[model samples]
Target chain A: MIELAGVTKSFGANRVLAGVDLSVGRGRSLVVIGGSGTGKSVLLKCILGLEAPDAGRITVDGRDAATGDREAFLACFGMLFQGGALFDSLPVWQNVSFRLLRGALKRPRAEAREIAIEKLRRVGLSPDVADKVPAELSGGMQKRVGLARAIAADPQIIFFDEPTTGLDPIMSGVINDLIREIVSEMGATALTITHDMTSVRAIADEVAMLHGGVIRWTGPVAALDASGDPYVDQFIHGRAEGPIAALR
Target chain B: MRLPLSLLAALGAAVLSGLAAVGRVTLFALATFRHMLSPPFYGREFLVALGNVGWLSLPVVGLTAFFTGGALALQIYAGGARFDAQAVVPQIVALGMVRELGPVLVGLMIAARVTSSIAAEIATMKVTEQIDALVTLSTHPMKYLTVPRVLAGIVAVPLLVGLGDIIGIFGGFTVGVQSLGFNPSVYIRNTWDFLEPLDVISSLVKGLAFGFIATLMGCYAGMRSGRGAQGVGRATKASVEGASVLILAANFLLTGVFFSL
Candidate 1:
């Protein structure tokens, strides 16, 4: 399980997160929904230790995450970035097996390549794509490659940031299904941030709405439609007139 | 009156911000050095960096050094002829190549090509959230990204400088014997006689320092770049400007120190 309490972050005079609290159980999917600039990404970054919260207590599996040994903590997690973030200079196989090529996880080159090919297969990519550079791949293919890399280590926890942002509807659905299958089959605790309702419906077991730097509503995915919170209602229906000022 | 006041305020603010940025960069660099000395080094990343910063740079470095040496030979021969001192062409060319031209020219070339490329590549990666991905994967950006490049710069630049020195001297020799009515044997002997260990060492040291500054500035600007196309452009420009200026300044100081004794 992952838990965050009283997390706050500010950049100069602008407060991006204001004492936000959240929790996710193991082997479950929690999808965070929010408008742009609403600190959803900030929250995820804080959890990943990419951004340090000014005032917060973050616990992972009943231990304090902030003060824990970083490498050990990070070794348990995998992440899929919004842009796929494949290294342009590296071939697909090298990118997929990057972590396994160094440090304590080091493996023989042939072994690492084999593992990369297997993970690629899991993500529905051909082994022939292994030698190609990231720039040679299409957007959907890159995302699949990113997914392959994320699950390469078979991590116990996974985070996905805006996973369906640039893909077409069909591709988005494919990615959403893949994410759902991986989380359930691998029994990994999954936390994802996205504005795509289709992805939310497809991947999430529980949905949380972030507004004004706090979770305005959170419940099972089925209850999201009848959560009765004005902010959730306004956001879900994509209505123009609501408490969330469209201009702001 | 309002414009002048605002301008003054802006200038003051800019100075303060610049100082702060420098301090932060210095701290980050120190942290990287600390990490580098510790165990669990990334061998694969280091090899990639060597390939990028060293081997691939040879063509450009070689071309620059060769041409600069040839040009220096012609100019020196012309100037020496005015005083019937054309025989000193080899000595002067060798000294110029080893002591000043070789390191400075190589540094400038790297600043132009390598620095801009690194900054732009990293800045694009930053804008596209690739650096963020590295962090999410449990990799420290400083260790995974900056350390290898900085180490490569330190290692590669000296080799480049040594290569530059040899190529430059050969260039000078070629021009001296073929075009300047000088004997090939005499020019080579003169060049050998004038060249000293101190000059070679100074050039190598300067190369190392220049390389470090150039790559450091590139990585620094790139990592701190803002999020957009315009921000990436600004980072690229700032990286080249910073690396070039620092290289020149460092070259002057190193020269002063080397020659003072």
Candidate 2:
């Protein structure tokens, strides 16, 4: 479980996140829907303590995220960045087993490689792709490798930032399905940020719309259609003329 | 009056920003040292950096030293002839190359080569979010990336400087014997006898300082880079610029410290 209370962050004169209070229950999949530059990524970064919020607190399973052993705290969660963020210098297997190759979770090299191959398989990749660098893989394949990495450690929680941003519709669907399956199978608490409606329908157990640095609406996925909030309505319908302004 | 005030204001702002950059770099360097002294040492990364900053740099350092040494010999011979001091070629060349040029040239070469490369690579990593990924994976970026490269520069560049000094002396010897019509045995003996331990020590010390400056500037510029391809370009440019200027400045300060004291 994750909790954020009265979280606010500002950059220069621009307030990216203003008084954000959000939480995700244990083992639930919460997908945040926001337009570009809506501070969705900032919210995730704040939760992970990657970016410090100006005010308020964030906690995971009751411990303040800002305090405690950083390495131990971070060990509980895995993140798949918007870009794959795979180490270009490393082979795909090394990237996937990065956590296992060092730090407190380190395993022997042979064992780490075996786990990387297994996780790659879980994400629909074969063993042959293991030795190749991330640059040699296609975009979709790279995304798959990233997913494999996120789940490789079997983390208690996983954060997906724009998991299907640049993929085609079919590939996006495949990624969404893979995410849904992995989160369910692992029983991991999942938090994802995306603007894709198709991805939301496919992956989200609960949906929250972010606009004007605040959560406009939040409910079960079934209620997304009839949320009755103007901002959510405008966003889900993709209407040019609505309460939500088009030009960011 | 307004024009002068505006100029003053611009100069003040430049000074302030420069001071801020210096402060940031100082803090970053201190943090890198802290990480270097701590545990979970990344020996593998350090070895890779050693190869990059040391072995891969041999050809360029050697070639630059060789050509510079040859040119210096010719210049000394030509200039000394006017004063009837052409016989002083071996002594001057030995002192000049060992005491100054060897370390300075190698430092500049590393600034141009390794500094630019490290900045570009790390800046690209920052842009692509690999740095954030490293953080999320529970790895300290400073521990994983900066310490190894900085340590390598500290460990390797001095040795390179020593090798460059030797190669440069040999180059001067070659020119002195074959080109300048000087006796080979006399040139060799003169070059050897003219050098002192202080000159060698000073050269190695300059190498140590210059190496630290080059790699530190590269890592500093890179970690502070902005986003996108333009950011990467700027980081690479700033790294080489910073490394070159700092190496030269360090060379001057170090020279005064060694020779003056």
Candidate 3:
């Protein structure tokens, strides 16, 4: 389980995340939904230790995020960055097996390559695509490659950051299905942030809404529509005139 | 009154920002040194850096050395002739190339090529969140990225300077014997006799110092680069500028220390 309590972050005069309290139980998928600039990305970054919250405590499985060996802690989690963030210099197989090729999780080169190709196959990529670089692939293909890398280590925790943001609707559905399947099969703790309603329906067991730097509403997917919160209703139904006003 | 006050404020801001940048770079250099000495070293990345910064740089360094040597020989001959002192041409050219021009010119060239490239590549990685990805992969950016390149510069550049010195003197010798109607044996003997061991040592030392400054500036600017294409452009420009200027300044100080005594 991952828990964040009273997490607040600010940049200069702009407060992005203000005392956000949220939790996801073990092996559950939580999709955080929000409009642009509402601190969804910042919240993920804070939990990932990429960005430190000014005032908060985050714990993973009962220990503080800041304690213990950093590398050992990181090894337990896998993340798919929003932009795919694949190393342009490396080919697809190398990118997928990056961690396994070195460090404590180091495996034999041949074994690592085989595993990478296997993971690639799991994400619907052919073995022939293994040698091609990230630049050679299309955006959707790159996202799939990113997904392959995230699951490459067979991590206990997986983070999907805007996984379906730029894909076509069909590709988006494919990716959404992939995420759902991967989470279910691995029984991994999954945290995702996206505004795609389709993705919310397909990927989430639970939903949390972030608005104005706080969790305005959080409940099960079934309870999202009838939660009786105006902000939640306004956001889910995509209504502009309600309490959660869209910025002009 | 208003114009002068605004100008004063602008000057003050520039000075403050400049100092801040210097402070940050100094701290970065210290951290790079620390990481380079520590374990969990990435051997493959180190080898790649050596090939990229050292071996690949040879052709450009050789060409530059060859042309500079020839020019130096011609210039010294022309100037020396005014006082019937043209015999000193070989000695002057040897000393000049070995002690100063070769290492300094090579350093600036690296600043122009290697430094800008490192900054641009790293800044692009940062913009793409690749650096953050490395962090998530449990790799320190300084260890995985900065240390290998900086260490390569420290090791490869001295060898390059030594090679450049030799090639440049050969250029001088070719021009001295073939173009200037000088005796080959006498010119060669003069160059051989006039150069002290200290001169060669000083050149290599300068090479190491210049290399460190050049590569360090690149990594520093890159890691701190702002977002967007404009940010990347600024980082590249700043890296080259910082590396070139610092290399020149260090060269002057090194010359003073090596030869003054």
Which one is best on lDDT? 2
- The TM-score obtained by model 2 is 0.99
Q: Which runs in model 2 stand beyond 4 Å of their true positions?
A: none
Each model's DockQ? 0.74, 0.95, 0.89
lDDT digits (tens) for residues B1-261 of candidate 2:
999999999999999999998898899889988999998899999999999999999999999998888889999999999999999999998899989999999999999999999999999999999999999999999999899999999999999999999999888888888899999999989998989899999999999888888888889888988999999999999999989988998888888898785
Error of 3 at A202 (Å): 1.0
Candidate 2, clashing residue pairs? none
Candidate 2 reaches a DockQ of 0.95
lDDT of 1 by residue, B1-261 (tens): 999999999999999999997897798789878978986677778888888888998999998998999999999889988999888889999999999999999998888887888889889988888888777666778888888888989999889999999999998888888888888888888899888899999999999998898788888888889889999999999999989988999999999999996
TM-score winner: 2
i-RMS for every candidate: 1.4, 0.5, 0.6
Given the true complex, what DockQ would model 3 score?
Answer: 0.89
CAPRI classification of candidate 1: medium
lDDT per residue, candidate 1, A1-248, as tens digits?
A: 99989999999988988888888999989999999999988998898888889998888998887886888888888889889999898899998997787765779999999999999998899999999999999999999999999998899999999999999999999999999998899999999999999999999999999888888888999999999999999988999999999986
Off by over 4 Å in 3: B1-6
| Candidate 3 lDDT, B25-129, residue by residue in tens | 888999998998888898898888888778989999999999999999999999988998888889998999999999998999888888998899999999999
For model 3 the local lDDT of residue B152 reads 86
How far off is residue A192 in model 3, in Å? 0.4
Give the worst 10-residue stretch by lDDT in candidate 2 chain A.
A209-218
